[model samples]
Target chain A: MSRALDTVAAWVLGALWIAPLVYALWAAVHPEAYAARFDLAAPLTFENFARAWAQAPFPRYILNTFVLVTAILAAQLVLCTLAAYGFARFAFPGRDTLFMLVLVQLMIVPEVLIVENYATMARLGLVDTILGIGLPYMASAFGIFLLRQTFKSIPKELDDAARIEGCGALGLLARVYVPLARPTLVAYALVSISHHWNNFLWPLIVTNSPEVRPITVGLAIFGAPESGVSWPLVSAATLISVTPLLLAFLIFQRQFVQSFLHAGIK
Target chain B: MRIRDWATGYLLILPAAAVLAAFTHLPIVRTVRDSLFSRGSAIRPARFVGLDNFEALAADPVFWKVLGNNLAFALGTVPASIALALAMALLVDRKLKGQGVLRLAYFLPTMLPMIAAANLWLFFYTPDIGLLDQILGRFGLPGRNWLGDPATVLPCLMTMTVWKEAGFFMIFYLAALQTQPPELKEAARLEGAGRWVYFRRVLFPMLMPTTMFVLINAVLNAFKLVDHLFVLTKGGPNNASNLLLYYIFEHAFAFNDLPAAAALTAVLLALLAGLAVTQFALLDRRVHYR
Candidate 1:
């Protein structure tokens, strides 16, 4: 009897959870008049998508997000790899002290330092640029920490063998450490991509023009109640911003799940 | 011919160190320094006014209110979400029919951007035409202004937060659960342990580390994740739902008061550092027991 109760409770909770997304789907595809109405016979139309598209610079915003996420990921992966490699393999002077400073970023995230970071960005002449939005996040402490632990676990014999085979530090890192820590890389990349993709406040402050503002910022402007857009259009815009990550997640759900698991476990 | 390996290591670490210092370490110093100064004009320039900004912060009613709201927001959202997440993880970890579908359903919220989730939830709170009110109408109830009313606004934001976060935290618990030894469960069953007993004695204690981690994260996130405020409340219907970070954003960007913003940011950093210390202490205690 309790087994039956548990299954029933689980299914009910699941349905309640997805009801919003389902509502978004319902409201977006139907005509504005039918958004709140639950008539099973509500006519479906792509008009909301078309109107929402015409109304906002979603394409440009999405392009900006794509560029930002990938750039940050690329920079983080490279920077973190080198840093993690340094920490894992060699005994550098002041390495522990520097590592502790880097770990400070974990506690004092970029979001908290917005006031001063913005000043630094202005000094660097990076304001209103995608680079400004991405720069503060590029040297991710979490990524370095995750990768350092992974790099430390690799067999020492392999490193010695690679060194004997004419692999310099950089070469060994590129060819050996990178490949060995692929799972950690994958895990960090997944977390980083999703994180920067969804990141808002920094991007909102840094990017003013539609040319550089990410889809999240763009969607915020587009759906701000003051804009007077209807629910259908807002839902459609929400769907557009989310569809890429949502689809990637659904298709690679298992890996997506495991990637977070891997990232968290470390 | 190769350089000393330690020297090479330093060279390898230079780029990340430079970036981290520029963004994190330097800004930290600047925030502290700036907080101690005046919001300068062209002629005046930034002059030292030690603790004046903090004095202003201390006296500001809105700051106190936002802090109170943040505390309530954390209090309302974090524990509920953690409990819900644990329950959801337990549900999915067992042998169940259609578990994949249930997992997908629960995890969908974590995939959507906060702005998008905020936009969707805004519709649900849209007074008369909102989904919540529409459901209420079926019972002949009148719809209250959910986001527009001050009393309801923070709770509304907290509800949306729980809805958004529980699923994300669930996956962490789920991950932790899946990695545990099956033998533990078998042994408990052999000893005729009830579900509640096994949960209290075995699962709960074992999941303590994950719980602590998630708890700390959830608390920090309550302070950090203010994206929904931009969409849902803008910290309004009279500064009712404003949070610390959003308040800082307003000070710097909206009001263009850099010194004031820096002071607030300093407070936030101190709060975060205090939490980090507490996390280490708790983790240390957990380790001692283990």
Candidate 2:
């Protein structure tokens, strides 16, 4: 009886949790009239999705987000690789203090300092640009932390052995450290991509043009109540906006879960 | 040789360190400094008006209300979500029927952007023709202006937030649980401890460090996540649901009050610093624990 009860409870919680998304799927696929109604016999069409796509510059928004995450990830990997290696291996002065300073970004993120960050961006002539949006996050403290922890775990003999092969500093990192930290790199990349793809407020504050704005900011404008909330259309747009990350997540579900787990445990 | 090594370390970290200095560190210092000065216009130049912004903050009712709402939001969402996440972690950790689908259902919300979640919930909260009202009407219940009413507004946001967050937090507990030795569970079973007893005595105590980490994160999230407000309330019905970050946004953009925004950001900084200390102290203790 107890086992059966537990099963029923788990299923109930899962059902409740998924109900909103299920409703969204229903609303997006059905006609506007069927948005609040449930009917297995309701005529389903893809018109809502077609209309939602044409209604906004979703392709451009998507393209901009893609560029943003790609640039941010590439920069993060390269910068974090060198920095993490420095902290993990070097016996430098103020090492712990510098590491602590880097860790500060983990808690007091860029979102909290929006007014000043916008000012900084404007001074640098990066406002309303994808580079402006990605700049503040490119140094990613979380990436450095994760990579540093991973790098520290590799045995010291490997470093000495690499040095014996006439491997210089960059060569040691490129051949030894980067190759070994591949799982962590993959995990951090996945986490960073999903985060930037879903990010909103900072992008909203920075980008005024649809040309530079990401999908999240575009979706916010599209769904703003003053524009008139058409449930089917908005639902369709929401799905369109999320479908890429959602699909990536569904396909690489285990990796995505593990990436988040890997991130949190550190 | 030591000098070359030290110089190499500095050179290696220069690129990332420089960017972090420009973006994170300098802005933090500037935010506090800017808070001391009032904005300048054509006729009058900008001038330092020390403590004036904070004084104004003290006098402003909206600031206090938003601060209170922020605390309430943290208190409401964090514990509830953590509990649900712990439950979820336990459920998915075990061998269960349709586990794949179950895990997918629980974890899906965490994948979508917060903006998307807000828009989706906005539709559901709409009156009369909304999914919520339609369901209520089936049982002869009246419809509610869910997001419009002051009473239900924060609760509505809280509900959506809890739904959005529980699954994400569950992953942390899941990670913690996965690392535990199987013998712990076996030992509990051998001692004939009931589920609740076993959980409270073993699992919960073992998960203390994770709980602290999640608590800090959840609190930080309450301060940061104001995307839903932009869609759902815009801090409406006399600013019933205005949170601190959203209030800062309103002051900065809507009212173009930079000094006020800086002051608010400073308060947020202090709060984050306090949490950071607490987290460090807790994690410090955990480092020496078994």
Per-candidate RMSD, Å: 1.4, 1.2
Lowest-sum lDDT 10-residue window in model 2 chain A: A1-10
**Residue A230 CA error for candidate 1 (Å)?**
0.8
Model 1 C-alpha lDDT per residue in residues A97-125, reported as the tens digit of each score: 98988889888889988888888899999
Please write out the lDDT profile of model 2 over residues B133-228, one tens digit for every residue: 988999999999998999999999999999999999998998889888999989999999999999999999999888888888898899888988
Task: Tell me how far the alpha carbon of residue B261 in candidate 1 is from the true structure, in angstroms, after superposition.
Answer: 0.6
- Model 1's DockQ score: 0.86
Question: What is the per-residue lDDT of model 2 for residues A140-178, given as tens digits with 9 covering 90 to 100?
Answer: 899999999999999999999999989988999999999
Give the interface RMSD of each candidate. 0.8, 0.9
| Displacement of the residue A170 alpha carbon in candidate 2, Å | 0.5
Scored by DockQ, the top model is 1
Listed models, DockQ each? 0.86, 0.83
The alpha-carbon lDDT assigned to residue A90 of candidate 2 equals 86
The regions of model 1 sitting more than 4 angstroms off are B1-3, B190-192, B288-290
